[model samples]
Target chain A: MAYELYYWPTIQGRGEFVRLALEEAGADYIDVARESEGIAVMMRMMDHAEHPPLAPPFLKDGDTIIGQTAAILLYLGARHGLAPKDPAGGLWTHQIQLTIADLVAEAHDTHHPVGVGLYYEDQKAEALRRSDEFCENRIPKFLTWFDTILARNPAGDAHLVGRSLTYADLSLFQLVEGLSYAFPKATGRALKQAPRVAALHDAVARRPRIKAYCASPRRIPFNQEGIFRRYPELDR
Target chain B: MAYELYYWPTIQGRGEFVRLALEEAGADYIDVARESEGIAVMMRMMDHAEHPPLAPPFLKDGDTIIGQTAAILLYLGARHGLAPKDPAGGLWTHQIQLTIADLVAEAHDTHHPVGVGLYYEDQKAEALRRSDEFCENRIPKFLTWFDTILARNPAGDAHLVGRSLTYADLSLFQLVEGLSYAFPKATGRALKQAPRVAALHDAVARRPRIKAYCASPRRIPFNQEGIFRRYPELDR
Candidate 1:
């Protein structure tokens, strides 16, 4: 049976991370929410499923449902050879993914500093202040960590763990893409300082399956509504 | 060999979640940062370790170093039998722990909405607005999810997963503790509606090892500087 992925229909959001992995592996999966009546089906699953998710972007494989992007990736990564087979190496890859998740959460908070419940317009002042700190500190801090790990990898700087392509590399590509889209000026500066990270992002982009997925209509374009918004004023 | 746990010495913060797991399992471990000159040692390790943690609350077991609170717990949970042995059940436990982590991050943001670099007083206005939404919506939404899972558990409503104690139950207990300390009024109301969750929190508190750990000075008291802080003005 093909895996069913349920997420918001319109934006890349967190679901895109999972989508990238599935696409890269050529795994048979359905973007459930993108289908007709999918949103209702998604919400009802949350309401009545044996193991309900607190939010969207959950995956149903057979009778097992997995939620939380990192946890989902952890599941898929091991099964698809997208993570190391050794327990220690696998755990390290997961640790890196969780760190990426921390940065992603912070990135989302830049545009909604006051409350997720409030509109961006209502929280503009706070967003401006938060965005400044994010661009100045958090982005560089997180990207530098990635660069450091890539440079320090025993195998080489080619991948985050071992010398193989893992989900972390795919997700890193997505992170850089989101940051570049959301804060072009700031991401440009940070990328220049972290060449290994920048190169890895580009390398992942060039992967045949990933490249095709990007060119295809299946890949959702970044917009103001998603986690990484291109609010020009907030970028600088 | 004794496990070495590294974290901020003064506050319970995220490290407490790990500490609770270690304590409950009666695992022999050293609180590295609590020893003299230990913070310097911890910082140096982050600077040079092959798998450097982005931040503290990292655990060093033999040569393996695990970071990220949930990731650390996942490692400890398996070895210590604090998690289910089955792969599917283990993943579900991790999923719940990750969700709790999301709420913990949100809870931290209530006080530092503008930036982690800025002090709470500097972001007081933003904090107040954020706290209102957190208390009114986020708390109930998260706690109710826990309650729902507890109620829906096939074995019984006593634990978050299976019939045995998992790290999710311990972490849920800590989450309730932090929320109750930080937003007593809101948590009180939320807990009233999430009786199963409330009972789990109480039950974890009374567990032999956990009970002793909480009473001993080994457990740091909740203070203003940690992720969860009591600011009466924002609690309402």
Candidate 2:
């Protein structure tokens, strides 16, 4: 059976991480929300009393439902040989994935600083302050940390863990990609100080499969509705 | 070597989740920040790292440094037999853990609705609006979803997953505890509609290890600095 993925139809959001892994592995999967009846089916599945997902961006494999971006990616990675085979290596990969998840949450909060429910316009002042902190303090703090990891890696800076393509590397690429889209000025500034991380992001983007996915319609565009949003005031 | 846990010295915060799992499993570990030289050591460690963790509540196991609450729990759970051994069961446990992580993040945002660096007093107005949406919309939605999961459990609602204990159950207990601490009025209102969830929280609390931990000095009290804080105005 084809793996079924459920997420918001409009934005890449958290679902894109899972989509990237699936796409890279050449796995047979259905992007459920993209189909005509998919969103309703996804919502109905969520409404089920038995085995309801805690939220969207959930993956359905036969009868099993898994949510959480990192969890979904971990499952897909392990099932389709995208993660490290060694136990320690796999755990380290997960460790990196979870940290990326933290970065994603913080990135989302930059725009919705006042409240997730409030419009960005309503929270513009707070968002501006938050985004300033993110760009000046948090972004460099996080990116530099990843850069340090890459520098210290025994397997070289090509991949996040060991010497292979783990989901962590893929995620770092996506993270840099999203940050570049949402906060190009800030990202560009930080990228100057994070050479190893920048190199990895460039390398991941150049992968044939990933390059195709990025150019294809299956890969959604980044927008204000997504986690990483572009606000001129916030970026500045 | 004993596991070394690093976090802020005072509040339970995210470290409490890791502490709970370690305590429940009877694992040999040290809460580094709470010890005599702990905070200094944590700071030095952070400064010395080529790849410092993005933030606190990280764990050090010999040479490996792991961060992120759920990821730490996942590692410890798998290593010490706290999680389900089966592939499907383990994936489900992670799904629940990630959802709980989401709830924790939302709970934290209720008070710091504007910016993490600013004082709660600075963001009181925005927090009030955020708290209202959280209390009226998010809290019920999340709690009721857990209630549905409990009601739909094929093995019974005694535990969150199978009939046995899982890290997700412990996390749910902590979630309910934090919610109750941070928003007694709102949580009280929500719990009335989620009897099974309440019951599960109580049951987990009543476990010998957990009960003892709650009553002991090891269990840090929730404070304004922590993720969950008591602000009566926000609750109402």
Instruction: Indicate the worst ten consecutive residues by lDDT in candidate 1 chain B.
Output: B112-121
Quote the positional error of residue A186 for candidate 2 in Å. Answer: 1.0
**For each candidate, how many residue pairs have backbone atoms clashing (under 3 Å)?**
0, 0
Model 2 ranges off by over 4 Å: B49-51
User: What TM-score does prediction 1 earn?
Assistant: 1.00
Q: Tell me the tens digit of each residue's lDDT in model 1 across B1-236.
A: 99999999999999999999999999999999999999999999999999999999999999999999999999999999999999999999999999999999999999999899999999999999999999999999999999999999999999999999999999999999999999999999999999999999999999999999999999999998899999999998
User: Where's the lowest-lDDT run of ten residues in candidate 2 chain B?
Assistant: B46-55
Backbone clash pairs for candidate 1 read none
Native-to-model Cα distance after best TM-score fit, residue A184 in candidate 2, in Å: 1.0
TM-scores of chain A across the candidates, in order, are 0.99, 0.97
Per-candidate TM-score against the hidden true structure: 1.00, 0.96
